[model samples]
Target: MSQLKYKRILLKLSGEALAGEGGYGIDPERVHELAQKIKRVRHLDVQVAVVIGAGNIWRGQIGMRHGMDRATADYMGMLATVINALALQDALEQIGCDTRVQTAIEMKAVAEPYIRRRAIRHLEKGRIVILAAGTGNPYFTTDTAAALRAMEIDAEVLIKATKVDAVYDLDPKVNPNARRYEHLTYLDALNMRVGVMDSTALSLCMDNDLPIVVVDLWGESSIERVVLGDDIGTLISS
Candidate 1:
């Protein structure tokens, strides 16, 4: 713990990450792998919080494009995040890691309601807290939720775990020659309009002076390395 740069961190993961090779739905093996990685981080005596998106189970945008009500679709997406959170909580528990699932929207049967003090207490007691339901509101992305929760919990850093190794000027998939940025200022990231995170999230982090790390989740011990201050990915800060 003395060697750790971040005593507490918020890991932001996409719903697609839990989809495995099929690119849809929860894959147990994938969830298990993610759990193992998280356990390793906890083993280092660091408090970990997670905010996962729901693109795989339900993409509200796709529904809205098909003429569905925006608020309804968003609410459905929020519920989908709860499903992912439960799956992740189960996996973490299976690995002998204590975890709690807190939802922004109340569903007492499945998870505890999101409460700032309770969540902080859980982390202090060495329990991983997985936050779900996207801020308990419509018209907000999970990215924004992660940002909000990170500040609410006074996290040392916000880790954006993604498939890509780092942030790039252009989509590396579309252009192989795109330049990757090892470090970026918050204003630079906001002006560039980085696709990995939304502007609202960026603005919130900027205002709060919270550092953001974009890293490849599958890289060998990548998440641990980030919290350990290894400079593993693109870091956005003031």
Candidate 2:
């Protein structure tokens, strides 16, 4: 009910979030639920771009440890992100929200290739653009891709939807005494090495002065809450 703080946002969702409780592949119910939440933000008239991770299906680095060729493994991971993007696009469209899936690697049969101008145009037209593949390169995580896309799109904020509510001094799951930060500066996170995001992603965000809000995606109305500028999670910024 409050004025929205972000007019345009890039939402970074981990592939594992789409897997839900199944632990593998896309879960239709979970995807639909997430789609509905996104719809709520659309109703708020905010332009949204999504960057989905492929770790639920495969991780290139992990595959390399098993003797798989690094490039081939990374390409496989990229394809996995495409799969997730397509699933999310379909789910969002099923609910009457316009969406597009753009991959860094060309996959004409499934979605459009990454085109910065075109993606921004889509957002301007009120379409949700989902970016797939990790920068179309090996050794880059989707977290980095999200940061890059956020900068390219000039999004007002980056909403990182994770399992946890916010960044903590330590792994909250393992360390019950870990402390949560309500707000953090980029330098603070770097100095402390908080694991909320990877170094590359953190650096990009820091350099760009992009603000980020880390929140639990599974919580009710959490996305809407964050968009409305409510104090619902950890906010990391300049």
Q: lDDT per prediction?
A: 0.96, 0.91
Top model number, lDDT:
1
Q: Give per-model TM-scores.
A: 0.98, 0.96
On the 0 to 100 scale, the lDDT of residue 62 in model 1 is 92
Clashes of each: 0, 0
What residue pairs are clashing in model 1? none
Error of 2 at 207 (Å): 0.6
Which structure among the candidates has the greatest TM-score? 1
Give per-residue CA lDDT, model 2, range 26-99, as digits (tens).
Answer: 89998999899999998999999999988778877887898999889988998899999999999999999999
Superposed model 2: Cα runs more than 4 Å off:
none
Q: Give candidate 2's TM-score.
A: 0.96
- Point out where model 1 deviates above 4 Å: none
lDDT of candidate 2? Answer: 0.91
